[model samples]
Target chain A: MTLPAEYLATPRLPLDEDGGPVFSAPWEARIFAMTVKAHEAGVFTWGEWAEALGAELAKDGDGSGETESYYDRWLAAFETLLTAKNVAAAGQLADLRKAWDKAAKATPHGKPIVLENA
Target chain B: MSAHDHDHPHDHDHSELSEIELRVRALETLLTEKGYIDPPALDELIETYETKIGPRNGALVVAKAWTDPDYRERLMKDATAAIAELGFTGRQGEHMVAVENTDDIHNMVVCTLCSCYPWTVLGLPPVWYKSAPYRSRAVRDPRGVLAEFKVELPDDTEIRVWDSTAEIRYLVIPKRPAGTDGWSEERLADLVTRNSMIGTGLALDPSSLEDAA
Candidate 1:
């Protein structure tokens, strides 16, 4: 459950004088910037994330917070943020979940498969 | 009434469960009863993927990139389109992007939330890539994670970690390996490994394979 060091530390990218992470390749800086912006926008408070993450970690029966789980906690936080912000109408998220479930069930590869009729 | 309990023979509580949960439970039970869901079989399948399919698919993509400049450029800019150009686009690869390695920069990819991998392009994700251990660690200590995979970058090289979200999937475009001069695309493709495409390992050279042989 030990986390990798790179995940824990913030990366320093080559930047111009204004100090923005430079993007030499496609979509690299955009994704990084979005992550940073999402954090700053009060979409999900870091404290809430830490608490939820700590709870999940505790479920592993490991007291140490050394390990960090992938996107589950973030998804949960995003869901909460969406709910709080009223971004979608009531039950939209639930509908999407149901659709995803149906798609997973219908496809052998656990993806949404489209079958064309002859 | 409690002593007899005849009227309560079938529990009504089962009807209260969610449809998805009920369906899942029923499917699991049916599969188990049919003897089609053996734990050993599942383990074997997992092992096969971990040992074979993942790496093979990765190698093919890397080799193609190494030998074909146009393909490599397309992959770097619009991965899904580029992969479709090669007639290998569907399923998990519907939305894909490629991250390229350069002289001063290195790239690594991870699914920070769930194991949302581009399986069509890479066949299957390795056990480490899908494991909680790797997912949690890769984001925080990419260099350390790469080290575990035996990929050590120079100190001067900047590392860029790509987090694959629910919408978009990512593939790592490893820098073309040395000693592959005048090799065919097919030969180059043979040197591409799944780990290389995932940015955990480097692509092999045809000369290296020749040396080993």
Candidate 2:
């Protein structure tokens, strides 16, 4: 029942008054968690994350636009960092993305999506 | 409950995936397959931020600082180590600077560049904290923002706002209330509100605590 203290870490984001879900969508939560996990695993440092995210937000010009969700920047920042850090290449990520698009289409409604479906 | 219960993994309409959704899933799959990510670590990380960390950690630190002089000295000298002494250290808290609220100096923290907060101590920054207006005005008119939070500091007090960035974060040690002279650290912690640590508001008045209880 006692997780290591490191497991119990990071600043909060996305929580509203109701103490609702920390993220608006499942993918948002996924990317958020993945970023933290990657940091812990030594894939990248939080400094690197901050830099990447800041760069992504900077691309938005004022960063208060209605078009892109906040987490979109998070994901964009993450993907860019992943490639920049050589954790994964741009071509590799792109390939996987296209494959998932196909896999999701192949999956039936309410079914768990599997990469094999690609 | 909404039909969007993502925890029910099998119940999601996989066929209705948004472009971003599919992209994220693909990234997860790729990272997992590459051994750079442990699949369960994602959930564990989420559970950590969602439940493990919070402002309570900062309250404990503030309370100890109030009750112990040597610890307070250490805290003022180096906040990151002082906070880690209470066993609250991780990514966002790598560098910390504790600024105390004195009779003439009122300290506040803001991440004007982004939401770079000391999550390891005070948990996440609030939604409004990330807004453009608060971010800008926190530097321009801290006293006004404090007034909005009902923390009317003395007119002569100089408000010092610390802009947190990726390199550093800050914690404000609110002044000990007049009547809390012999209070236990635990009791003192009850007065240390999250806003107090952020410098947006003062610690809860001792009388207010009594009234609430």
Candidate 3:
């Protein structure tokens, strides 16, 4: 039940009491489900997805990055795989991103931001 | 901001999520708009991953095998089919091989290449399971690794480390603990830890559960 002072002082991810991964934000779980759902729909194979993820993680070299960045890589690689597989074009996703920014701003403070609001 | 902190909770609602969150949301919305993903299916996927589809599924499979001799025989003969019969079949679980722990042989699983786990049953592999150290040590110094997990075994016991691959994954059936011979599979499942199914840990001692309760 003891620990090195430096290791204990270091910032760490928030884990559930039972040590399950606690998604810091809801969107982390959303993206996770999106990846699984995409695979189920045959947008890409698990092999391709793994390769894409490996490629993205390899960008981190020693893989000492934080857990948050891991999911960033996950999302980046997912987008790459979708584009490479001709499932979703880069431009379309970018446009949607802009649309969401506007939609989020135009909507009331606490309301859900829908595409039509853009 | 501090003055109204407790009163104005919506003050920073827009800033709650990071840029990446917004990006992922955008991606999901775009995919739905373009017909690549159905909202209902996406919802179900989120729900399944969040609520169902985890170690509980594997725990159930192990409990069934422990309580029923025929089910145990089926699981040993054809893990994938028997597992699927219990409604956990998809993704990385199309092919499964179940190994049993006994008084002599102990089983452990590791993916030396990448983290290829029985996701349909165990959900996702733990962060350590995907770490380089685990991937290496699980194969090289299994006893030492198990010792680190606080799982000490007799020196004479043999440890068989199964390498999980995308083609085939493993589910370890830890030996049923003595006592409570008349336990239902559901209650027995409460003793099955995720690591037990993965073979890195053992079934919870019934007494331990009692102490926790």
Candidate 4:
């Protein structure tokens, strides 16, 4: 599905200055800028991203030269970036994965807390 | 508009929740009864979040970015620390990240997996944002969706869509509006609508505020 023009034309605030595009509010912008800075500093490269993403997509055996499957590829690329940069150690990521698993098990169906009071 | 004039059921009468709220409550109850969560604890958590870390905090952060260039720079680099600079970091925003827009590239964020947002800075994701229409369309055709919201960008701009799947969350920093020279941060914050921060609209100008009034 193509993104709507209205969504595209929305003037992005974070992009106002040459620094970078803010993802959400200023705080979110700040974190994104840091990530970009890190990427530019040779902490990671796009090739690593492509490789990681390629590997992840390969698991499904559907890497039929489709760009859409690149989403998983991007995720894998980011995982590699994090590991290479020590932004997250493999052990730490594993622990987080385990915690997420536990949380999912404890709260299956993913009901949001917003509806609890009724 | 004055906060008092805004017709929020929660502010006026707690007993009369909106239909959305009612559905949310029903879902909560179902989840609890089905052994998905601890009802009372979740209720307390939700209440604590709504009362202490809602839209007001988001407004404050946006306002600060508008007024303070140094702070804005810090915010664009380390959102968690920058927001913490204002003492607004907590919960969902503990791992907050920011994305900046440039002339060549524009950033749009979505949680295709779920409604993961920097709630500490953005409060709640609007109903439309969580809709399947938005999720499925945002990354694929952002320009068209933005147009529906009345935000039209130049064709030359490259769109970079970010999907929030991990604990890391995103927020958009909107451009400072025109014709607001020497405005205080507090006033600027008032002009920073949630939609602007979500990259769905631009900051309101004085004329738009007058029209709204």
Candidate 5:
């Protein structure tokens, strides 16, 4: 299967063997697929995604000295793209995130997180 | 694994929500609620990586090398090509190196900077692999790190730790366990654990396999 070249060809993208992107947590995969799907659905061009993600990676030092937090920057770039494209308002996203934190706090460990106010 | 003094007490606490975990969950919820994501598709993608694509591929490679001396020599000589011959190649494993563990030597894999792992074979790294304690201690005190994992080696066994990078990744070819003569590759593969390949544990003994079953 052909994945997005914009991400695959990017030197910064860290993929697993088989060329698919690797994620440390389920949420990483979730954000990643969302970004790919968003690009596929014409919400933004691959160039835009690449530029935003590239900037994020460079800003964070790109695993030279520390390798953690690549996907964290990815999420930040994804949000930036969403807000820039007007696909989702920054305030709305922030509000939902806060709501999730509250839900997660109330829920016990090993249980799936469900947003109460969403 | 037993609690030890070397354990980094400030490392990730399993009891509470990690900052990344909480943030990712929030993002997922927001995206799904906004119609930017399909819940089922996301689930399928995650499940594929978590289960279908993981260390089983590495286990198969280890099993083959254990059974064939020539293959073992080839694997040790040129790991990237040898692993590719077995159809395990890509991403974090572009440049691969195999370090063999013998009676006199032991090898361990760690990424001091970040969690640069051989995902093509081993899959996503376990939480402990990415913890700060492991990243730092694996380089400083490998034996202490192994002890926390309950892996005790003989005093004379020299330990060689490989620090992974984005350019190259190392996989430990753990020595084959005894009493498995004439065992099928599939059965032998089942005895290989993720920890064994990482040098934090050893291949399972045949009797333990029966007990596990």
Candidate 6:
């Protein structure tokens, strides 16, 4: 499938390659799809996402200039936009983060990590 | 693009979870609970990237390239069209470049700006690829990173590092092993590992396959 052509405009980031989206983990794909879905739903404009994501990318100002947790930065930008758009509350996200951490700790390995109360 | 320093989820053990795994789960739960994301759709998406589209596709391409000289030339001349010829195209791999590993030079891929990997062919970028250490160091010290991966090239072998981005993706066509002279594409495909295609490791040797078989 052809990717959205608008994504081609992102100058610095587009030194990209072809084929469908790939993620190292399920969550990476989830978050990536979510962002695209949200944009499609008009939750926020692409410009809005770029600005928000740009700010997050620019935060690591150490001039040594490195890429770290690319998806983590993406997640942060998504969170920022979601909250700014009031789609989800910041405190709610925080609470869920803690809850998952607790749930994950309680669960054994190789088992599907689920939040019973979530 | 390659394996991580720490153990990630594999077929054998899913017990040891990373912090990112936990955080991702948390985020998913929160988003799902808030009705921001549809659980069914997310599942489909994950399943697609996880199993439906991954390194296996690239393996097919590599295997075919290994067995067919004409296909290899086409792959080198135009990876996108060549890859598409085998029916692997879409999202993370709209623009594809295949770099061949030769006796004189080895090619490695890293996205210093972000984990810009050829997801369609590679499955997912490994956790280590996205890690800050690998991103920064892969460029500064390719030989050191190769050493850590147990891939020691001779001093005369030049290493060409390809930096990926959102627009283009790269696949490393590892040199075929010696003993597989008349191997079929199917058998050759098994020797093409994700790591081998990323230039972090070499293709499995025939002797190793014999031992395993």
Best by DockQ: 2
- What class would a CAPRI assessor give candidate 2's docking? incorrect
TM-score of 3: 0.54
Writing each residue's lDDT as its tens digit, candidate 2 over A1-116 gives: 23334433322234435443344333565687787677877888787777787778777765573322667888888888888988777588778878877876676542445688
Distance from true location, Cα of B21 in model 2, Å: 16
Question: How good is the docking of model 6, by CAPRI class?
Answer: incorrect
Expressed as tens digits, the lDDT of each residue in B136-172 for candidate 3 is 8898999999989999999999998887544667889
Stretches of candidate 5 above 4 Å error? A1-118, B1-52, B113-115
TM-score of chain B of 6: 0.75
**Poorly placed runs, candidate 4 (over 4 Å):** A1-118, B1-53
Residue pairs clashing in model 2 are A12-B124
Q: Considering summed lDDT, which 10 consecutive residues are worst modelled in model 3 chain B?
A: B1-10
lDDT of 1 at A88: 34
lDDT of 1 by residue, B1-213 (tens): 011111223322111223433332232233334343543444333433233221245456666777778777766666677777766655333467777788887888887332366766775455566566787788788889989988888999998777665456778878887877887877777777777878888877557788978
Global lDDT of each model?
0.53, 0.72, 0.71, 0.54, 0.72, 0.71
| Clashes found in each candidate (C-alpha, N, C closer than 3 A) | 18, 1, 0, 52, 0, 24
TM-score of 2: 0.54
TM-score of each: 0.52, 0.54, 0.54, 0.51, 0.56, 0.54
Residue B71 lDDT in model 4?
A: 82
Q: Which pairs of residues collide in model 5?
A: none
lDDT of 2 by residue, B1-213 (tens): 111121222443335456786678778887787787887666655554443333468999999999999999888887888898988876333577788988998998887432256766776555567666888888898888888988887889999887664556788999998899999999999999888999988888899988988
**What digit string (tens of lDDT, one per residue) describes model 6 on residues B1-213?**
221111223332223335665556666676666666787676555554554234478888999998898999888888899999987775334577888888998999887422256766777656566667887788899999999999999999999887664455689999999989889999999888888888888888878878998
| Cα lDDT for residue A28, candidate 5 | 63
User: 4 or 5, which is superior by DockQ?
Assistant: 5
For each candidate in turn, the interface RMSD (Å) is 18.2, 11.1, 12.1, 16.2, 7.5, 8.5
Give each prediction's DockQ, rounded to 2 decimals: 0.01, 0.21, 0.13, 0.01, 0.15, 0.14
Candidate number with the higher DockQ (3 or 5): 5
Model 5 TM-score? 0.56
